[model samples]
Target: MKALSYLNKYLVKYKWYLIWGTVFTAISNLFGIFPAQLVRYALDLVRETLDTYHLYDGSTLQPALYSIFAFSLLLFAGGTLALALLKGFFLFLVRQTLIVMSRHIEYDLKNEIYDHYQTLPLSFYRQHNTGDLMARISEDVSKVRMYVGPSIMYGVNLIVLFILVITYMVSINARLSAYVLLPLPILSVLIYLVNNIIIRKSEEIQASLSKMSTYVQEAFSGIRVLKAFVQEQQSAARFEVESDTYRAKSLSLTKVDSLFFPIVAILVGLSNILVVYIGGQEIIAGRLTPGNITEFILYVNMLTWPVMALGWTTSQTQRAAASQARINEFLNIKTNIVSKKDINRSIQGEIDFRNVRFVYPDSGIVALHNFSMHVKAGETVAILGTTGSGKTTLANLLTRMYDVSSGEIRIDNTPIVDYNLTSLRSQMGYVPQDVFLFSETISNNVRFGRPDLPQARVEQAVRDADLYQNVIDFPEGFDTAVGERGVTLSGGQKQRLSIARAIARDPRILILDDCLSAVDTNTENIILNNLRRIMADRTSVIISHRVSSAKLADYIIMLDEGTIVEEGTQAELMARNGAFRELYEKQLQTEEV
Candidate 1:
């Protein structure tokens, strides 16, 4: 019910279509029932004509038999045929409107989920898997579409047809109608029991499918690791376990369905039997005509398939209910990184952190503690830190990727949270260690943030990142494809492309989070020289473990266990012989520089 209410917000625009479609459905069902009523009329006509007052008794003209029977019978046949064709036309319109509405709803719901995902903090993603999320957005949402469309259409249709058929049957002979409906209470009890089991089984099947999807996604994403370790057999065995679980759950749901349909068939069959016996007795007692019995029998036969459809509708509704719950889970999550209300300030290069602290959710480990820093506009600051020393966490906090646990961060002397999220991030060009490039031409990747960037600016950023020579060497030059995640490029080439993308943004603050590590000394030097000119009038924060990179900073801060333990020029830090000096010595030895 909650899911239905949530989805209803998307349906307000389609109310007209839903209303008209329902009207057409009721009209079509009436057309379908018209022929059955004709059967009753025709049967009565034949009986009356052959009665003691008619042709067989010579009380009526023989010519009246041919005229009345031929004209009435032939006319009803053509009328019934015409009505059936008209019903088909109305059914098409009904489906075109309602089914199309469901499709639109599906499209909107999927995009809504994806947009919500984008707003959610990275922490949420850490707790969820890609494949499970994919299952919810794709398969689960599709199931809900079925509930809104065909199931509702058929369910309403059956109701209209059933009411008309049962009402007319009672008018023919109320006692026979009552008897035919006797097994109904029992069928109702069976549906209640069977529906509960089907709902439970549907939840299980969807869950198993999501888990299996997650396993398959992970296996392929890490296939290189599996082959390197010769773990193909192990991976396949694990996948087999998931597949078997999915199969078992599906068959269990099928088993519930298997029991359900037969019960419905038997109940419908019982209704036919009651009509046959009780209705036959009414004819002999002369309380009812043979036409009424025959008509009642046709009505029961017409009802059989709808009784079967009841079970199907029940199963689909239950499955759709289960799917709705899964989709709602994602839709209802409160965002952890929402932008501050009424705040949309532009950024300048100056940045400050005042006694800030941060801890990862679900992990007790503190990433930052009482961290304070101040950087003036138009200055370059280098952060040297060991692994897990809160360098990346600090950068993330500045961007409001995850808000600070305590204290505050400021940009341009204003609180960081005082700016709009999009506006705040737009001020800085951040290139992280892992560069993810889309499968597109070199020019497109470079101008990702600004699709309308002029060609000259893009080429200039490429030259600044020391990648122009490489880009031009390719046969297609700037148009060459990068493949998935830039797989076609070497590590250094990928990093240079990342730098080019950042440089193209031309923001007030530039952050390179160890982005130069993959490049060799000469290439790194050339990139740094280019960045030096770009950072001359903007604030730049360089996070690296390299002593060579740190030496060029106006000032350097070395982090140890989430605290700034050393702050000085590179020469001063080396002279003090602290952890920063030790790191510089080790890197120098490794590179033999």
Candidate 2:
């Protein structure tokens, strides 16, 4: 209930729906109860006709009396039918108001969750998996919708029926009503005990489901790798384990849920027994009529559904509570990176890393240590590094993907945080080492940064990235769909397409992070030559290991273990007997061999 309290706002938002649904439920129950009374009247009339026949035995008026009795029974039946139709109409209205409201709420809640996911920091994604996040938004939200729709509607119906039915029973005979209700308290206790178990089991099932979904998603994403390694059997076995755990937890919850109907049925049967036994005794003592006993039984029967639904409503509420708690966990997380000031200033790409130090929050790895550098606007500086070196970290910091742990980064002589976050990132074209293209056409992928670009611009950017000839060779050319993560394209083509995407943006600053590693040396040279022309005016940072890529830059810096080991012009670095020169000679030797 405490976790579900988060939905109080939405409840208030759609308060009118709830109010009207409640009204319709009450009206429908009122009409439903009257049919039982009509049955009682019909039975009483039959008994009265019997007495009258005895009084007027052997009279010629017997035929006329029978005609009158027939007419009276028809009136009672018509009244009962009318009341039933009216009850059904209001029940329809109840569903319209309540169930429809739940669908609307479901839409709003999913949007809120997805919007929140967008605002969450990168670290949040590092901590949580996609399947768990998706499960909360999709499966968990569906469970909550059950509570909001059917559970709520049925619960209201139950309350109204119980109040009206019990009131009528008591009005007729308080003692008999008391007897009929005796088993109800025991039923309530049982529901409470069973529901506690249900909530626990439901939570376990949801967790297991998340784990299973994650495993399946990863397996599909890595299907190629799995088959290449001939580990399909092992992967399937692991999936089976997860699936079995999910099945076990679901069965455990169902077993607890299964107790609900039987418990209600048994208690309701007990109430019916008490009503008959006690009401019969009263009739024998001349304190009650057959009609009174029948009416009491009808009232007990009317309460049966509501009593049974008590268990169902409570079960749904508990499940909703568990799910809402998971949702609230993500909603409560505040992103650390946000624009301090909403100022969109023009940046000329003069970047300054003033003693910048950064540690990965998830891994506690110091990716950069007291890194300091300055690049004037329109300058191209190539960053050289080994695999674990801090090359990509520099690009991440410049783009504000993760803020520096200590010290500061400034662009255009102002603190990066001072600029509007969106405007800041919008102006910089960043191509990561790991390329990712959407499952969209190649033309759309290249124009992703600036969607309104004309085809001429897109083609020119492709030419600049040394990918024009390859794209033209394809049957669909620019319109060809790059399947998930550009899996349809070769690794080199994907990298080249990524480069073309960055080039199409015409950004004030461009940071290419080892984007040329997949291409051959000949192709890399052609792309670097094209890049040098495009990057003449715009500030550029090229991160790579190969000396060929670094030679395009006016200045070069080599890093080892997060610290710069060498920095100089290519000619000056070649003159020195340093790490940079050693790497250059080794790479030259490899090419020669």
Candidate 3:
């Protein structure tokens, strides 16, 4: 129920529809009660043996009966029509509002989560599953919609129907009404207990469902790997296990559901029996009339639905509450990295790291300790390191993906935090090791970084990346769809297109984090030569494991563990006979063999 509060803001906007819906429901119930009362009155008229009765003469029984029937029919028609119109309109309003609110909330939550993801350090993503995040955004948000739409209307209708039916019953006969209501307190207690159980079970069900979705998503995405390893049967067996767990959970819920309705029916049946026994005795003793007993029976019958609805609605409420809590947990996660309050500056990519130290949030080992580095406006600096040597971490910190735990990083002499995130990130271009492309044409993918760029400029960037020849070689050339994540393209082609996309931005600083790993040494050298010519006056940071790649840079910095162990030109480091020399000699020997 606490999760329901998220909808209060939207509900308030459409309160009028809810009010009208409730009002019409009450009117319908009122008219619905008339049919029973009409029967009772006709019975009384016959018992009185009035051949002719009028209001004034007490003698025109035929006209009276005709009038009663006609008037009851009219009320029934009108009430039915009103209830239909109200129900239709109310459901329409609720659906429309829910759709609109779902869209808005989904948009807001997705944007917030995506923005948070961008700000979070790389380690966060390393520890989390991509499929789980996708499920939260797609499947979990849908659960929130169910809670807001049908569940809410049913819940409210249950309450209104209960009050209306109970009031009518008490007005007709107080003592008889008490007998029918005696079982309610016990029923309520049982509902409360069941609600707690349902909440816990429903949460477990949702969690299992999320896990199942994750497994399916991962298996599908990595079907290539699974088949490559010939693990199809093993994968199927694992899927069977997950499916069986889900089925078992669903059966458990069905068991609870089966018991729930029967218990409610039994309670209602007991109330009906009590009403009939006591009310029949009263009539026999002449303490109550036949018409009164009939009316009491009718009211007792009407109480059954509200009771059953109470149970059903309680179950839905518990499920909705659990969903809301999960959604809130995701929505409430605070991003560790956030833009400064007074972010009003732009960046020009003169970056400096002063005595900086950083440790991954989930790990104790520091990735960078007392690290100091400076890159002038137009110099190309290359970072050479082993796989875990903090090269990528340094690149990530430059983009503010993670904040320094101590000291500071300044962009253009201003603390990186003080510059607006969008403005700062827009000024830099980053080509990651793994390139990702949308399922779009090559031209569109290249233009993604700068949508408004002129066609000529786009073509220029493609040629500059040395990808133009490859694009032209394709049957459809630039219009060929890249397929999912650029699956249609080879590794080198994807890397080249990614470079083209980055170059399209015309950024002040370009960071290539091993972006050319898939390209052969010959192709790499060609791209590096082009980069040197095109970005001669623009700052660049190239990260690489190959000594050949680092040889093209004006300065090379070698990182070990988290700190820079050697810094100089290729000639200078080789002459010094340090770690760089050892790596260079080993690579030379491997190449010779």
Whole-model lDDT per candidate: 0.85, 0.91, 0.77
Q: Pick the candidate with the highest lDDT.
A: 2
**580, model 3: CA deviation in Å?**
2.6
Clashing pairs in 2: none
Steric collisions counted per model:
0, 0, 8
Every model's TM-score: 0.95, 0.97, 0.88
lDDT tens digits by residue: candidate 1, 247-342: 999998998898877998898889888988998899899988777778788888878877788888878988999999998888889886765664
- Backbone clash total for model 3 is 8
Model 2 Cα lDDT, one tens digit per residue, 502-572: 98989999999999999999999999999889999999999998888987798898998899888989989
Give residue 328's lDDT in candidate 3 (0 to 100).
68
Q: What is the lDDT of residue 382 in candidate 2?
A: 93
TM-score, prediction 2: 0.97
After superposition, candidate 1 runs with Cα above 4 Å error: 50-64
RMSD of each: 2.1, 1.6, 3.8
lDDT of 2 at 75: 97
Candidate 3: stretches off by over 4 Å:
13-123, 285-294, 585-593
In model 3, the Cα lDDT at residue 554 comes to 79
- Expressed as tens digits, the lDDT of each residue in 122-166 for candidate 3 is 666777677667766666666665555555556655666677767
